[model samples]
Target: MSMREKIKVAAARYPNQRSAIMPALLIAQKEHGYLPGPVLEEVADILGVERIWVYELATFYTLFHTEPVGLFHLQLCDNVSCMLCGSEDLLKHIEAALGIEKGETTADGLFTLSTVECLGACEMAPVMQVGDDYHGKLDAARVDVLLDSLRAIAPRAASVENTSSQQPGE
Candidate 1:
């Protein structure tokens, strides 16, 4: 669907046009995989709000990718608790297994490795999140298994989705 069509759909759902900013941005991101400046402006235009308002919302949420991200976003926690539990080793294992450096996406755009301060799962230290799923108490072997499974499964899952239905804007 076109960006204009997405905006119209979002606008129809909200009581006020401005309230659709987040949902509109999400729709844009789902189509493009990230929030580019032009798309943000488009969303702002649709919502009849200032561009900065859309920009602010996008920048404030870590879940909203401002730039293109790989198919799998691997978020590893490196905070005090996770660090004490050997998150560094887990990070290295993931990097080596994926053949990509930290803060880098793989050549195939399959994976992106990123370190986060805290995931707020201290009890499950040395945790990593792939997409929306979390894997806790990771070791090298577990990380390998997790990546393999995700790589094998994600594409099939994505293909099975019915594109005709619009995803609800988170």
Candidate 2:
């Protein structure tokens, strides 16, 4: 189904139109990779809500990305629990390994490293979130292993992208 249809269906679930802002944004982001100005406006238009309302929710949440992001987004939890459990050191190690600091994507656009306030997995402190999966109780070794695995997966993801982008005749 089209994004507009998906948004309408999602909006139907909520009594208030504003409540559908998040679901609508998620649908838009999944279709566009990121929520650019035009895409945000389209979502607002489709929902029959104010543009500011869509922009407000899209910008406020970390899950929604307004700018382009890499194939893998590495989010490290830097809250007190993670801090005490050595997230600071882990962050440094990841920066060195990936050759990119926080808020930056790798040269190949494979990874984007970021530090979030929390992941709400205090029991499994020192956690890193790559996409939707959480790798917790992390140390240098675990992080290294995780990075290596993601690297291996990158080529397959690239190939999939290339395949999907090809025209039937071309």
Candidate 3:
């Protein structure tokens, strides 16, 4: 089924099509990793709303990523608690280890580092979210282990994908 069809099905659960904007956007974002301009326009078309409305929501929510992200999207918290716990130094450590600045993905596309205002766990100061998992009370040692672990497994994961994609003769 097409993306629009799937979104329409989700929208059917709502009282009105407009009420399903969040689900529709989520469905659209899932179909495409990130919501580019064309994807936003298509979502607007699907919902019978202005393109700007879709764009506004896409830009407003931290959940909806506008650009393509790497296999691991790392969101480091920069809230007051995390800042006081040295999130800035943590950010630098990630950048140096991943060889990419904040808002940038690595050359191998394994990691994307970005900062967020909060991750809703102030007590877990100096916390970072890798995908859905959260690492709290971080130090440089933990960061090294985290990056090393991912880097070590990334090659094996890629090889599995590569092996699966290869043909019987090619």
Candidate 4:
């Protein structure tokens, strides 16, 4: 679909044009797999807002990808609670398993490992978010299992146009 068509769909969903920013961004990301400058501007224009507004929204939210990211944007919480529960070790395991450092995407563009603050699931410390799903109480073994699960589901997810896909250069 064209960019205009995509923005239109997003704009139609909200009562206020500006309120559609998030959903519009999601649609833009679905089409391109990341929110590049052009996409952000396109969204802003369609919503009758300034480009900086869109840029601000993208930067403020960890969920939005300003640069290219992998198919799975893995966010591990490293808050005090999670750290006490061995989140650091979990982070190490994920980095090793994915062969990418934190805030970096795998060469294959399959995974991007990142560290986040509290995920609000301290009870399930050492938690990580893969795409929109959260996996908690993770050990190396469980992390491996989660990766496997993600791999298994990735193809299906990519086939759905609205679902997240691996970003280019990831």
Give the best candidate by TM-score. Answer: 2
Q: How many clashes in each structure?
A: 0, 0, 0, 0
TM-score of 1: 0.80
Q: Number of the top candidate by lDDT?
A: 2
Off by over 4 Å in 3: 153-170
Residue by residue across 39-85, what tens digits does model 3's lDDT show?
A: 88888888887888788889987778889887678899999999999
- Candidate 2 lDDT over residue span 1-170, tens digit each: 67889899999999988899999998888777789999999999998999999999899878888998888989999999999999999999999999999999998999999999989999999988888899999999999999999999999977775665454575
Cα displacement (angstroms), candidate 2, residue 162, comes to 6.6
Tens-place lDDT per residue, model 4, 1-170, is 56678688868878888888888888877778789888899889988988898999988888888898887899999999999999998888888888888999888777888888877888888888877788888899999988998889878765663443434353
lDDT of 4 at 145: 89
Listed in order, each prediction's TM-score against the native is 0.80, 0.92, 0.84, 0.84
In model 4, the runs with Cα more than 4 Å from the true position are 1-3, 153-170
Q: Order of candidates by lDDT, top first? A: 2, 3, 4, 1
Which residue segments of model 2 deviate by more than 4 Å? 159-170
